[model samples]
Target chain A: MKPLPRIVSVLSAALIIAAAIGFLDAAYLAAKYFTGGPIACSVLDGCDTVTKSAYAVPAGIPVAVLGVMFYASVLVLALVFRERRSVTIARLLAIAGAIGFLASVWLVSVQVFILDALCLYCILSAGSSTAIFILGIAVWRLAVARANASDAAGHDSTAGRLPAVGNK
Target chain B: MSKSSIAILGVVVLAAAGLVYLGIAADGGPAAGGQAAIMTAEDHVKGNREAMVVLVEYSDFQCPACAAYYPLVKKIAEDYANDVAIVYRHFPLQQHRQAVAAAQAAEAAANQGRFWEMHDMLFEHQGEWSGNANAAELFAGYAAAIGLDGDQYRRDVEASAGRDRAQEDFQSGRAAGVNATPTFFLNGQRIVGPQSYSEFAALLDEAIAQNR
Candidate 1:
């Protein structure tokens, strides 16, 4: 019911969206490997270039495998939270999501600028992560509000009155 | 905000999440779209067990490119023998005069379960058999050199069955988008031109990891 909780819920939804993108990328890779068909990549020779590139696989596993892990982790971070710790947890999740989003963006840049190709799924994953990061920042602001409210309410004796960025 | 407000937010978030999932699952996505042509030599593969990797080669015995690639392909085949299945498909170009005939001879040997042996012999004496002058004599000698039933080989070479098989292989290569000699398909993905052993090994490693 609190503002912080509402913001956390929104971020959780965004995290799920990113995870969905990751799942789709993984599924497409699976289908291409087994069926021997043209992988409909978004960019020119996207499928061929990306799949054939040495960077496509890391540690003997497809890069999509790692995308799925990162997205799922973000989703879990968003979904699991106690109202008492909602503010702190949401902030932590947002910071992590931003880091992940930047990483994805870097990868997409490499794919396009260096590889001279675009992988649709990679684009989607990067775009979704960026969205989640923005949503996460909003959640972090709400957490700052919650912390400020708790301090003002005399609920936490050890805390000082913090800056009021927004109503909790 | 009340408990009802919280409940409404939860419902919206969950619904949006479901929609996101549906959007992603709507199509098979980018990775499963292109269809690479499968080579016909895939049929001659009598080995029951599925190989870890199939090296489908489009080769012309008399073509210089084919001759150049011969050693690399041989090295790859030997290095990855049990793990990789090598399917040689004839891709005799019109420029190469005796390539079709050489391919026919190889096919005839294949019928007698000596396809690979005859294949090696053809590559070994590419210069002598590649010319029109002594092709038959050189081919017959190769048949004898490989300990084939020389008389039957001569008959089979003249039968047109061997020639037909070679034509079929050439057609298959064309269908698979082979424009030049020594085009290779490693597990159905075309790996163009002659590359180092390490390159082939690396690609094969990726294919095996994918299979696992």
Candidate 2:
């Protein structure tokens, strides 16, 4: 029931918000993709171009659906592990964040080089994923620092205990 | 911010700037060949026949974006009547159930020498028939309104040649790397989207100046 460390709380909060934003952005695109509706793009007037590009759907699956799944998983993980005193959650988040960031980079490049257009929703998802990745890194560092502090405290009874399964 | 955070920020900024630069650069340059061969004498063309600036559009009638660009396209054809020629090609997306039918209708109307009228009517009344279950019937009404023989128009709309003509346009668009409605090729250079008239005018003006 104890409150999480300041860094952990901040990072967890940031990650959750970012993931939520990513989920909404991707979900909206996916809905429009399936329903054959027009995408409203303000930043760049190429939402339709980018969404209708060959790269938009891979293996008969809309990329926006994959994005929705990715953001949903990250959001769940962040919520469940927010107050955990272990590095496992942070490491998992970092890995997921890295994957999302890399995917965003690839998709954005497709929009740029191949499609020659920009979609505001796609950009929003990319920006949110990038923010989550950065926060994940910070969270990982904080978890490592906490673990190190615990180790240096020796057998001190007041020191925080690491989860037995994720002690590594 | 931490040094690591600052470094991450710098990397992101660099990457974003690089992407923006690449996007702009990619949008430049003339589009590849093959489009010229696709245009036949039968294609629907508007404006000056000998215009230096030729704008080819691969569009879907049922596409909202295409509808949005309809007036702008008409304006471009009007404003640059002497300097530009606009060619229409069909690129119906599979997702829109009415797109192919609409394309066939347009082609059917073309069989009676009313392609442009039907084209304008379809786009102007897109909202009325976009999701209708009987789009073909709606198209028949449009044909009648445009003064075409309704019976012949209906028969042509259902004919294989009408479908074939639309398919031909789709194939040509695919070959030209058109993946979306309202994709424009200005002077054989690709420009995507229902972009503003000013943007199109600016590019057209530049191309005209360069050609001169």
Candidate 3:
């Protein structure tokens, strides 16, 4: 089997790591929300306030649960498509990342303005989502580049050149 | 990096900056052009009316955070009985299915001069009725438990007066930049969420000292 391109491997690694961070951050918040315990805030000292705020839950569902689901989905997709250079998978990653990014934007805004409190865990989760989104965009670009390179090489030589397309 | 990579980085930076700006703009502080109205005699009051410090809370009864802060806030009121005045306002969020109903129940109780009793009962038993399909029935039970006239309570719950009162509080909250509960205005400065009693006491102390 051909080895993965350096760029794809790096991007996949970053995405997985970022998604894992997001999942853990969200999981902690979900646990705190359900168990009725205070969230320990080291940096900003408002995790409890922000997490317990009205905006913390949307549509009666915990935002942390939603965050967990989002990160878990992204993690699964990244692993499932690890071996293949599927453009569809790349697009899916981009879409998921974009959604997470936008959500981070809204949540951060709520923390800054409405809640008047900053949650360290929330900020960490937002950072992870932002990282995943940036990586997702890079991966998509890489996929597009590979596709273009393959088309230029044509069908006969494309298979042989596939592994080398995105390495440089 | 390639030119395309540079371009992507530029776009990312711009997007991040834009989002940060939006977040700052969205910060729900008092709206532009008008100051929120001050609490009046019509508002429900707890503790000493002659207190130098006034802490007005805009709360949704069904909010879990509000329930969590209930004991802490009640304790504060007790501790600063003579030094601070606590005012309760209804700001039922649209999200909580039972919030408005609970607010109305408290309003209904207000008519019978038992608002604080109902408020305490609702927050204490919040988990029991917050998600129940028969929340209205549960609230009615609470009204009766708090010594309100049953028939009068039921009628007031359905009355526009209760709803209108809640709406007025919500509008004032919005006008004052309240985006979440349980939001507290300590002498007109906003403090959001469940804060420690010590923190609250400190703020209260500061207000008292400032007044001196």
Best by TM-score: 3
Question: lDDT of model 1 at residue A92?
Answer: 72
Q: What is the TM-score, restricted to chain A, for candidate 1?
A: 0.71
State the lDDT at B29 in candidate 3.
45
lDDT of 3 by residue, B94-146 (tens): 65667788889999999999999999999899768866789999898888888
Name the weakest run of 10 consecutive residues (lDDT summed) in model 1 chain B: B28-37
Give a tens-digit lDDT track for model 1, residues A1-168.
233345445555565556545555544553443343322222122334455456777678766656656665665555543223356666777887788788787778777556544555667777877877887777667667767787767665525322321335
lDDT of 1: 0.62
Output candidate 1 Cα RMSD: 16.3
Worst lDDT window (10 residues) for model 3 chain B? B28-37
CA error at residue A66 for candidate 2, angstroms = 17
Q: Give the winner by DockQ.
A: 3
Chain A fold similarity by TM-score, each prediction: 0.71, 0.84, 0.86
In model 1 chain A, which range of ten residues has the least summed lDDT? A37-46
Error of 2 at A115 (Å): 22
The C-alpha stretches of model 1 lying farther than 4 A from their native spots are A1-168, B1-49
Q: Clashing residue pairs, candidate 1? A: A37-B34, A38-B33, A38-B34, A38-B35, A39-B33, A39-B34
Give candidate 3's total backbone clashes.
2
The better-scoring model by lDDT among 1 and 2 is 2
